[model samples]
Target: MTTAPLVRRAHDRGIAVLTLDSPHNRNALSAALIADLTDALDAAERDEAVRAVLLTHTGSTFCAGADLKADGIGKGPGLLVGLIRRIATLAKPVVAKADGHARAGGLGLLAACDIAVASDAATFAFTESRLGLAPSVISLPVLDRVDPRAAGRYFLTGERFDTAEAVRIGLVTAWDEALDGILAGLRAASPQGLAESKAVATRSLREALDSGAEELVRQSARLFTSAEAAEGMRAFVERRDPSWAL
Candidate 1:
């Protein structure tokens, strides 16, 4: 018997559709999933007909961050940082289309994209703090895209925010019912123009990640191996509040 892939890919017009299909774990970024996504991106990039990439999900939760059982935050930082950096620096425009919830490192994935379009039903949060972790790796992409004040609030509190709040804070590009217009726009643009524009737009984000990736990965490793993170992750996996929670 063969296992189903965590991610599925399809080509539509000039857009390469990469769907996160692992609903069982809320499409968490496991090693397998990340590898598959990276492979899909490589394939799309090599294809001359592909002008842009559209990232979407198949379940109620777009992504619930790292898979605690598989990744446990310990192994996730390096893998996640590499994947997100690839997205940030990809030559073609990558758009995230979300209609569900994105948490922790999952938020980083979408934020790394050139544009993120969420439906009104979409929700988001920086949930790392609640798990005795910081949004260290994700901060590279997220902080650059969002208002610092708002990032501080969500990053510290782990409070959930909706699409309207997301857009207001610049976390999401827009909250539309569908992505037809965005797809059409990408399809209409010339390939070279899209690549150049994406480069100009993502230059700063790329620089930030390039400069800080090592430190952030170290920070994540430190946090994940600590007693506090251990207890927090235990509580989370067991569906209970950590000892530190008031």
Candidate 2:
């Protein structure tokens, strides 16, 4: 059987919309997907006509998180960490159009974008703790976007939260039925203006991510190799709850 490319790119009116298309795995952040996303982002950045970038997905679930069962499980977290950093530092304005659920690492991807517009039906969660892992690498972006108090609650509990709650906590900018207007507005800006503006806006976030990425990636790698996380991942693939689940 032939599988489709994980990430798809489309350009319209100076906007480069990158869609995560691996719905078979809920657009999971596998190595292949991560590489494709990185390449797409680079292509958009180099395109003189591309004024803005839209990060979205094709499936009902935006992203289910890392491909834990993939052959390169240990490297998934680090690659995701790099991807989020790239999105945050991208010269063009990047918007996340989340039309579906985004969980665990998916939330990190959403948070790293310059703006996130989610649908009313969209849901989000941290979900790492439930797997006996931590949102270590992802925290670089997640912590900056969400309110500290809400971050504390969600980070520890890994509970699924609704779109309204996600907006209130700053996980997303707003819930909108259509994103064409936003994209149009973004397209109106000059490439130089957008680049300068985004550079100034995300300077702190870029610095923070760069400074903490090494440690966070190490923590993530360590957690993924731990006995607890091993058991949790095994249970997940086996279609059962984690051992720590009540």
Candidate 3:
């Protein structure tokens, strides 16, 4: 099989590993990376040989959100949203083996997964507000994983948080001493049983979101017009630190 921008391998135990391969850019979600990731996930979903999918990266930083320099803007065709949706609906369970910094969009990817095991060194941030952009697409997974009050603080402040906070807020399922061991244990489970359980859980979660999504959007829209957001973006462009320091 051809190696994609994101590499994929099926282990003997029917566990498929999808490794984000762009280390130089901190595995930022470039257009090519997003396209390759979507394709790779789709292939894993279709392959009968695969049971569970493990998402990981091969660098010190798991992902640094979207590649803002690549396209002059961080937005990249909304591919991340589509990829997250695919993972959410996949029959098999998807686990994120996050060992490094998973900021902004990267946190969204982790949130979308059925289970997430983060290393103690893992760090997360929602820096979109600092850059004058909204974490609009990522808000879905963020809301799913984090409490609304916690989300408001991080979303508005764009502050960085540690792995323990991630676990406390439900973004990470657990913190593992060794990611390999956790992954091994997850891979040992019955794929069929895991798939059914994940499907039911995801369905319930989606229903809850569907019921209140409109109100969420309305509130976010109002925030877009706030003076703080405008000042934050201006400070970002001027190469000065934002005044809204936590």
Name the best candidate (by lDDT): 1
lDDT over C-alpha atoms for residue 190 of model 1: 93
Residue 48 in candidate 2 has what lDDT?
A: 93
Judging by lDDT, tell me the better candidate of 1 and 2. Answer: 1
Pairs clashing within candidate 2: none
- TM-score leaderboard ranking: 1, 2, 3
> Candidate 2 at residue 170, lDDT?
94
Distance from true location, Cα of 168 in model 3, Å: 0.9
Which structure is stronger by TM-score: 1 or 2?
A: 1
Let me know the TM-score candidate 1 reaches against the reference structure: 0.96
lDDT of each residue in 5-30, candidate 1, tens digit only = 88899989888999999998999999
Q: What's the CA error at residue 83 for candidate 1, in Å? A: 0.6
List where candidate 2 sits over 4 angstroms from the true fold.
1-3
Each candidate's lDDT (Cα)?
A: 0.90, 0.87, 0.77
- Where's the lowest-lDDT run of ten residues in candidate 2? 68-77
Per-prediction RMSD in angstroms? 1.2, 1.7, 3.9
